[model samples]
Target: MSKISKLFKGSSSSSSSSSRSKHRSRGGPTPQEAIHRLRETEEMLTKKQDYLEKKIEQEIMVAKKHGTKNKRAALQALKRKKRLEAQLTQIDGTLSTIEFQREALENSHTNTEVLNNLSFATKAMKKVHENMDLDKIDDMMQDITEQQDVAQEISEAISRPFGETFDEDELLAELAELEQEDLEESMKSMGGLPSVPSSKLPSAWHGHRTTTKKRVEEEDDMHMLASWAT
Candidate 1:
């Protein structure tokens, strides 16, 4: 570009910069500084109000002291007390206004900070999700759901019965019945009692029976001796 144009641009830029600085300076104090100033003013006003109250009380006492003995002095003292009370009232109003302003400033500062944080969070979220979109998310979820369904089907297939099934309870019941039959048969066989012979027998029969018993005993002895020898 031409030298004249460049010089003009430079001057314009400097003027603009100065204007911005001036505007910034004229924009007044920050929220915190303003709030601090307001609070200080409130405290000063409060102290002044207290002083005025005390002065008013003193003036009342002076007026009471003059009572009717000195009506003009009493009137003057009462007037001074009224003026002090007015001053105190004005201070009270001023302090209220300053407190309200401080509170408003604090709230505004808090809102601004909250907005800044939200904006930062929004930017970060956008940066993190820059390459992501709803379509991809939906597709991913669909794939996950499909995989889960396949897994569920696989699990079900694995758990399905592959062989013939029978009622084990019925088999156990039949086995129990067989065991009961065997038990009953064993008990029946064991329940038999040998018949007992009558102690009194005819002489002839007894002599015969004794002979037979002797013969059987002799055979048993021979068999036992044979077994021992072998």
Candidate 2:
């Protein structure tokens, strides 16, 4: 190539190399992404391995079929079988590596998720407690208790009878005084009874009998009233 052409080619190659390097240096795939890719690779490798196994079997059968009848043919078939087996073994190793990598990535993903959840919970708890303290909580509880006590007192007051209060002993004493006054008024209203005459006259006798009957009736009335009062 000419010098200019060579220089242009070098520049292109350098540019391509730098781009590849940058791609390689970019942030790695997430665990989920890497595991997905590993699983896909494992599946592809498994299919290849299966194909190789079938090929190996076919080669073995070919070798057997040519066994003594054609030594050269049998040798070629055997050689092909050996190559197929080697490829299969390599594929198996690759599968094992892929499986291990996938498992490691899964474990790492689970651990990361758990850590994130724990961090979230911690932040939530901190936010909830930001404006609170033990002293404030205690004060709130005390206030609640005081309010409850006040409510209880109000309830008790509401439940009581709505009426004027009176002393039982004082009421009894007043009633006794009223009964005494009634008895004295009854005795005074009767006034002095007519004096009994020593000498008997028909008129005097009639008057004495009438007075006695009236006094008896008054006594019976007083007894009945006293009984009613009691």
**Best candidate, TM-score-wise?**
2
Error of 2 at 8 (Å): 31
Best by lDDT: 2
lDDT of 1 by residue, 1-230 (tens): 95535654765686567557756987756677667657765765666676778889899999999999999999999999989888888888887888887898999999999999999999999999998998999999999999999999999999999988989999999988876676555445555323448687899998897788779656755654454446
Clashing pairs in 2: none
Reference-based TM-score, model 2:
0.57
- TM-scores of all predicted structures: 0.53, 0.57
Model 2 residue runs over 4 Å out of place are 1-25, 162-230
Score each candidate by Cα lDDT.
0.78, 0.80
- Model 1: which ten-residue window has the lowest total lDDT? 187-196
Question: Would you give me the overall lDDT of model 1?
Answer: 0.78
List candidate 1 segments past 4 Å from native.
Answer: 1-27, 149-230
